[model samples]
Target: MTGLVAAQGRPVGTMGRMASTAPLPLTVGFDLDMTLIDSRSGIAATYRALSAGTGVPIDDALVVTRIGPPLETELAHWFPAEEVPAAADRYRALYPSHAIAPSTALAGARESVAAVRALGGRAIVVTAKHEPSAELHLAHLGIEPDTVIGRLWAEAKGEALREHAAQVYVGDHVGDVRGARAAGAVSVAVTTGPCDAQELREAGADVVLADLTGFPAWLRAFEAARAA
Candidate 1:
């Protein structure tokens, strides 16, 4: 759970279909990469560019498969520990040109966030991605969140979620499940990232959906249950 906090007292992450909530807005936290945006094509392209620039071989295909962790964590697999910082910097530098253009929203991403906003809830993105890169992807696709917090993963994501008063956290990774639970938020896992439904369930996800397409209905049910 490597944490990259945003100064002091910053909020982050959440999800669903639709049902008007209480007068107060509910804050929901989301994982950026596979959860909201499918940046694999762009990420792999960036890695290829980085490998070309550094003359170090990186398995771009394999890299995209594990997209939840920090950039440095992936770089560690290829670069020497001492070289990771420099490599990570280079990757971020290459991301805008190589990654952003090809990046796209996962299924129901826009609707899921919109559903939250429709209910007067705040939709926030908490990701291990570089903040600037995350913003670029969102801007490119026009899938907006109220707030975006970057460089946070696993349980470290809880810090942002807790600060934001998020009651629900949605993502496509087990790390995301851990993050939601760490904040004492309901973990809604989507099988759109690296993890499968069984894997997410085993990780203690409160609910599992095939993709964000199911989120709206699930959210409606969730709101009904809560209101009940």
Candidate 2:
């Protein structure tokens, strides 16, 4: 069991959900990459570009499959520890060119963010991508979140969620579940990414939905039940 401090002094039990009884605002946090956008093509292209420039052969297909983690982490798998930093820098330099056109918001992504706003809640994005890159994706997709915190993965995401006092965190990766749980927020997993429903369930997601399309109704019902 991974231990994490509760957000805003709220009690977070073993379930990793906030145990507070006070009426809290419906703040929601989201993961970018596979959760909101299909960035595989762009990511793969960038890796290929890096390989071409550095004369290092890279398996773009394998790289694309491991997108949820940080670019450095992925680079480390291929490059030596000493070479990772430079390789990562090269990758970031090549990313924007390859990313812009091919990257697109996944279905129901906008609606999910809109749902949070509609419920008088603030929507934020926490991602492993660089902050500027994450911002570019949001701008390109025309989806607005109250805040975007990038370059944070796993437990590091917990600190940001705590600062925002998020009640719900939605994502498509198991890392997202761990992050949400660490922050004591509801971990809502969507099976639109590489991970299937059962995989997400085993990862300890509180609620597993087919995709973000189901989130609005689920949130509504959850709020109604809480009120009742």
Candidate 3:
């Protein structure tokens, strides 16, 4: 099971979803992409499709390694700055059909979400992927988050979290951490994205975990800490 030390020094992970022995105080949120699903396969396939259309052969390894962040940002990395916009558009056009369903949720992701909902917490998914595109991804992956807000500007996530009344959020990227902090949500970092532990720590995540397999217990602990 994944492990994370809560603010109150409680070791959480195994059986973490148990109701907080203490009073609780916060809503929960989640990020998509690497946080909920392993998007590498779909993302890589989308890029591959784009490459085929543009007649540019890209190394699948190189493409798969950079799957987080906004699609536009990825386009910039894969193509020249000037061509990024067009390339990104093309990528998005083919992505839904080619990548969404093929992308599978990460291990233990759905179970953790269910645990959150069972605990009377409202779980929301806030992502930078375009709304229509994100919907496709969710549908393809057979996931239906409580509420999904997508196609947000990188910085807009914080504001969205605030609007959603999220008190804590789980994510796997620096941007996710920033958005959660900006919205005054406790940032729980998961090492499922391109970022490493050191990088996430440097980004000031409140808690870090290897993955969501052990999130229920942490959520319970978090609720308890909030109540206190």
Candidate 4:
């Protein structure tokens, strides 16, 4: 889409630089798991519990390390293809208890959300997590995004981004870069998740940061430059 290249020939990999004439984004989308919350412990715990109950040997480390993909995808990795559906059901059934309390907001999560709101922009979370679970995390963190979309990943997430007219999409996975590109939104990748900066960039991230901590400041600078 035209919006994917809307930055007017600016270098996509550079942070804190936007064209002065570029339009300021009014809607921003965020990924939930690594981008906003540190959920590895909870996710690992749930998988361990599932393994115990089913007598299936699940590698807790592997599960935790692969958090960005949907739970079904993870389940398929651990279970036989034919058994994946039932295993996914059991995982979801046990997820809430193991996940909720252990989850915590990542550094700058609140401030990043605030930065978007401070710009009179709407903040929305688009994630591959189940809707209820994603909502639970947001409620527990006391972060009220304008909307939360769940169970959509990669290009599927682009549909929601387009629906919201999101101008910027921030995430911590390669899938997020694909989603942002699909939606024609600016892709902001953070290295807080399993993927490294180079991996995210290779997946087509327009901008990359060390973590969410740098986002608010970069966003402010972008807006300031736009206004100048």
Worst 10 residues of 3 by lDDT: 14-23
Cα lDDT of model 4 by residue, 108-156, tens digit? 9999999999998899999999989999989999888999999999999
User: Arrange candidates by TM-score, highest first: which order?
Assistant: 2, 1, 4, 3
- Per-candidate local distance difference test: 0.89, 0.88, 0.80, 0.90
Candidate 2 ranges with C-alpha deviation above 4 Å = 1-22
Residues 68-157, candidate 2: write the lDDT tens digits: 888888988889999999998888888888886789898889998998888888999999999988898899889999999999998789
Tens digit of per-residue lDDT, candidate 3, span 1-228: 457877776676533655545434356778888899887887888778888899877776786775657777767766889898888788778977888777888877888788778778777888888778877777776776778888664457889889978888888888888888898888899998888888888987999999998788888887766766
lDDT of 3: 0.80
Q: After superposition, which runs of candidate 3 have C-alpha atoms over 4 Å from their true positions?
A: 1-25
Q: Give the TM-score of candidate 4.
A: 0.87
* Residue 211 of model 1, lDDT score: 88
Tens-place lDDT per residue, model 1, 1-228, is 354434553322111112333323477888988888899999999999999999999999999998898999999999999999999998899899999998888999999999888777789999999999899999999988999999998999999999999989999999999999999999999998999999999999999988899887777777667656
Residue 136 Cα positional deviation in candidate 2, in Å, after optimal superposition: 0.3
TM-score, every prediction: 0.88, 0.89, 0.83, 0.87
lDDT of 3 at 14: 32
Segments of candidate 1 deviating more than 4 angstroms? 1-24
